[model samples]
Target: TRHDFGSIPQGQVATAEITVRNTGQGALKIEAVSTSCGCTSARVEPTTIPPGGEGRLLIRYDSGLHPDSGPVRRYIYIASNDPDEPEVEVIITADVQEPTS
Candidate 1:
């Protein structure tokens, strides 16, 4: 599973795509996706993903609310049915840019 973020601007909305694949032979049920901060929001595509299949989770961060620092970091909490990896955490990082003249 990988989270890809395209180019984004400051004081704008940045989106992240969280992908999950059922590498195992069993079906995977995603309990939920939580965010570390309120400025960050997340939504899952399908609640369940079949074996050998994949699912997507969308996360958006309100960059406008974040401080105009170098980089903003956040985490995504994932709950799944995979035995070996029931729970997984993903990291998100973005460099906020200042408005130019």
Candidate 2:
């Protein structure tokens, strides 16, 4: 899953949702969701997905903690039970800007 939040205010929090689909014939069990830093976090709902079904991954970014004024990129690691691909990487990006007053 990939998401671009465009531009966001410096002190605000940004959120994005990713969908995990089970395209394979077997069940998809999401073991964990992790992020690179504390400023970013992710959670998976309905972690066990049946074949042809989907699950939701909620990602939150604390832009206030990231005081940079340029493009920002974050990565999410998803651990699953898929034989072919046990782990997946999700990218989230945004531009942090000072609030216009």
Candidate achieving the largest TM-score: 2
Q: Which lDDT tens digits does candidate 2 get at residues 1-101?
A: 68898998898899888787889998899988899888899988898999999888899998999667778989999999999989999999999998789
Each prediction's RMSD over C-alphas, in Å, is: 2.0, 1.1
Model 2 misplaced regions, further than 4 Å: none
Q: 1-101 in candidate 1: lDDT tens per residue?
A: 33535345677888767676778887788887898988788866788888898887788888888667466778888887778987788877777777666
Candidate 1 stretches with Cα past 4 Å from truth are: 1-7
lDDT minimum window of 10 residues, candidate 1 = 1-10
- What TM-score would candidate 2 get against the native? 0.93
Alpha carbon lDDT of residue 29, candidate 1? 87
The lDDT per prediction is 0.76, 0.89
Candidate 1: TM-score? Answer: 0.85
